[model samples]
Each structure stands twice: as structure tokens, then as C-alpha cells.
Target: MGTEVQCTLCPTECELENHQVGGCKVRINRDGTLYSLVYGKPCAVQVDPIEKKPFYHVLPGAKAFSIATVGCVLGCKFCQNWQISQALPEESEHRDLDPDEVVRGALYYGCQTVTYTYTEPTVFYEYMYDTALLVRKFGLLNSVHTCGYINQEPLRELAPLLNAADVDLKAFTEDFYGRICGGRLKPVLEAIVTLREMGVWLEITNLVIPTLNDDPKEIRDMCRWLVENAGPDTPIHFSRFFPYYKLKNLPPTPIETLNMAQQTAREAGLRYAYIGNIRQSGENTYCPSCGKLLIERIGYFVKQNLLQEGACPYCKSSIAGVWDQT
Candidate 1:
């Protein structure tokens, strides 16, 4: 009893004995106290375009100072960043960047947004929470790219400091999540709803893997649910999946499948559905009412943004996004 603690950050509810790490391999129990081992330690750090986070609606083309530590809550067989996400935090190379240093790095790199990405930010919750607070002092916005496999309390606590988020929907069925992701679907869905309730700008990313979760009907159901629960304007990115990690036996997701998902989303009342991983017209943001081009993107780079003060120039339709940081 003196040397055991439970991690309530996520649905996993990992209970650990003294010196034992949780499922995330980041949070550890030490003498009846929980400690985050990856706090102030980042394995990856860089300046990336905000679009790379697939947050098309938030600060388009703005540079984001991105950082991530190793370890993830889910065991996605096809995780692109499994090299880090699957490893123990100390097993990877990391930098000694504290909250203040993280803020300074973003400012030094001319990035107005700080993104906790490349791996699940929830695993490193303490670090991200502290960094978000420090970054706010200097007028920098904070964003998270996550799996959304977190409990409501921690997510609610973190929401006030967050400006935007991109949650990976992964798939629509509990079976797919259990078999392919080693997780549950319901918690992720709840996380999405909670983020929206907190008034956080939310976007979704669904990687359409061939024959796995690429069924058009399921995609439509997911879209319809978003439209009903999260709203029609929630931007959804249908990302193309490439073979990686344990799922390399499967071929990459076909272009046609991504197109089908995108079409399904629009038809299901989603106003801003996009295709990713392949370059084409789906990358651009068009006005839902006027069908006029609002933000033209060419493979993660903004070609032209025609929005005049966050409204469509032709019809003056209000675009839903965080256009201004101030």
C-alpha cells in the first residue's frame, strides 16, 4: 500500500508498484508517488509547418515549434513513428529542454505556435502542461497532435492552455481498435467530445488503410457522427496509409480509397474534408457555400489564402478556425 499508485491519465488505469512504469513507459510510481520520467526531456524537436500537424484550419502555414518524447499509450501496429512511440524514453536520444527552454526555442525559431506532436502528448502530460503555461507568457499558442486516448479530467485540465488539436480517429469500430491498435474506441470518442466541449478548435485525421478501416460505409458513419456531435465544420483529414512497422505486409492505401472517404465526408454534411499523403485538389480549402477557393494548399504549403479577415471574400461566409493568435 505504501509503494503503489494508479495512473488515472488514461482509460488504461495502469497501477504500478514502486519503481514500476505504467503502460506508457513514461509515468512511473516511486515510493507511492507518481513521477513523469520524460518531464523536460524531448527526443524530437523541430520547426514544422502547422499544416504538417494536419490542422488545416488553425494558423495555416504558420511555423510550429514541434517537440515530442518517446512512448505511446496505444500499440498501433502501423504507427509511422513507432521507432520512438514504441521505445522507452531513456532508450532514445533526448535533449535537456525544460519548460522555459521550450518556450525560448519556439520564440527563437520564429514559431508562434508550440506543438506537442510526433508522438502521443498525453504520455508526457506533465511536460506538455508546464510548457503550454510557459509558452503562453510570451504570446505563443499551444497545440497537441494526439491519439486522444486520455481520461476526461486530465484532458479538461489541459484544454484551457490549448488553442487547437488534431485527434487521430484511427477507425470507427471497437473491433478494429482492439485488434489493430490494442485500445478501445469509446474513450477516444469521448475525448473528442470533451475537447469540443472545452471550446478547443478540433480537427480529425483518419488514415485509410487498405481493407482494414477503408470501408466507405464506416467512413460515412464516422462523418455523420462528427457532424451530429462535433458539428459539420469540423475538418477531417483522410490520410493515406503506407506500410510500416508490424503492418508492412499490407499495401499502401489507394488514392481511390482516400477520394471515397473525402467524398463520403462531404456528402455526410462535413464542410471541410481533406485528403492527405497524396498531392491533389483535396488539399485545398474551399468555401462550402460559394464553392470558392478559400485556402489553396500545395502539399502542406499554402499556395494562396483568399480569406479576408476570416470570411470568404466572395460570400462572406465565416470560416471556422483560429485565424488570429491575438
Candidate 2:
């Protein structure tokens, strides 16, 4: 192994030798040049409710045409979508769809948004970037479901085209990130700040695993950081972790733990904190000012919306989200 070339996309900054792929598995060094193997070859494509992205604040009940290629930068042990995220291009079933075709597919499906989801979109950067441009040109919104492991410069370039994003914060500690996810915490936190600063409608998901990252104090600290950096209005979803992938040995996150984490977020000055995976009243959106329910969601479907345009009817408090113009 000689003649190393570094990938500046994420903090991993994987330096690849000849014929070596980066940590993502999709980006490889071929004869000293870096190339993305899974470009335009999306393995998963489906139309889903925008709420399913758990982007509760953006385009409420709109349908999003979601697409994903193989590979991811982070290898979280409890990843539910590990089949696609951990697989290489050749290891997954994929279909050929260029940027233009992806835009067309969204229109054909009567979707208001195009989402890069199911797997980490950052590893399929080239494809997502190109498709995002076309998606904007077609007047369709662009969104991403990601792990938030990315560099600032690339995120800056990608931000303008993005209308919404649901980032998986995963955990609060560097110890948990390194030991459990094969990644770090700082870069993800940096990326979240970058996204928020860019005016992208952002939401965060933290998979609460029992006996791991379920500490209420640690969650409160995480919530405080988000409130300080991303704003108190930023929606935080503390998702339940099922036994999956490499972490199948661990028990699922308890409902009480998820509730405690949500309570911790609210106590830490967060305006919106939600519980996910298993349904409860926390799935709906309410006004932080008057305690009036603004949007009532039944699972992934919006059952009722009581907002007058974008603000709560009772209190007229401005909800921090892209509620209209989908």
C-alpha cells in the first residue's frame, strides 16, 4: 500500500492506497484517482409520506419520492437499514436512474419532494448533488435522511438545494460514537450546525438504546447543545432502538427511557421533542407557547392540522418550520 490520497468528505478523511476504497465502500482509489462506484445506481426507490422521513416540520402530509444507493460513511451497530448502508454497489440490487430520471420519477409519482433516504446520502454525494439540482429546476423540493457525518464545504454546496433534512444524531458521547458507531461525534455536530445555519429545515433523530445512550443526564446535555447550536425550535426525535444488525444482542429501548429523554429535552429548553419507533402522543406537534396542538399526526399520516397558515390558531405563535409552499 503506497501513494495515499485522502477523502476530505467526512472526518474519517480516509486515506486510500492504490485500489483501496474509502471507509464508505463506494468511493475507491483507482490508479490514484478517486471514483464513486454507486453513482446513479439507486438500490431503493419508493414514495413515502414526508412524515415517514420524520420530517414533521416540513411539508407535513406531502408525499416524497425517496431514493438511495448502497453505502454509508458511518457503520452504526444498531442500523435498521444496514443491508443497503453496509453493502457495496455489487452487493445490492440496483437500478439505473440518472439525475434527470430521478426528477421525472418524482413528478410521475405526484410527489412534492425528492428524498435521498434509506441509506446515507453523503456516500452517494455525486448522485444526490446532481439530482438535487434537477429537483430544484423542476420545482420539486429536495430532502435528505442522513447520519450527518460530513464536511462543511460539501455541506455548504449542497445546502441551497436542500429544503429539508432529518439527521440521525445517534448519541451524545464520543465514547458511544467510537465504540458503537465506528465514527466520531464532533463532525456530526458540526454538520448539524452547518445545516441549521444554511436555513435548511432540520430535524434530529436519536436512536435511544438501553444501557447505552439512554442516560437522562447525557440526553439533557445533548438537548442543551442542540438548543444552543441548532435552536430550541429544532425538532428532536428520540427514536426507540430495536435489536438489529451487529447490536442484536442488546435489548430494545424502553418506552419510559424514550419518554424520559423527551422530557429531558423539553426541560433543557427545547421547544419540540418527540418519541418515535413506538407510537404515543409525542408524535404530534404542538405550540410551545400555548400548549395547543398545531398538527395532529396519526403515525405517519397527518390526521388534522389546526395551524392558520403556519402559526397556531389559538396563540398565533410562529412555528419554526417550512409549513407551507410544498
Best TM-score goes to which candidate?
1
What's the residue-level lDDT of 38 in candidate 2?
88
Prediction RMSDs, each to the true structure = 0.8, 1.3
TM-score of 2: 0.97
Give lDDT per model, in order: 0.94, 0.91
Using all chains and alpha carbons, the TM-scores for the candidates as numbered come to: 0.99, 0.97
> What lDDT is obtained when candidate 1 is compared to the true structure?
0.94
Question: What TM-score should be assigned to candidate 1?
Answer: 0.99
Q: Write the per-residue lDDT of candidate 1 for residues 77-167, one digit (tens) a residue.
A: 9999999999987778999999999999898989989999999999999999999999888999999999999999999999999999999
- Candidate 1 Cα errors over 4 Å, as ranges: none
Runs of candidate 2 with Cα error greater than 4 angstroms are: 1-3
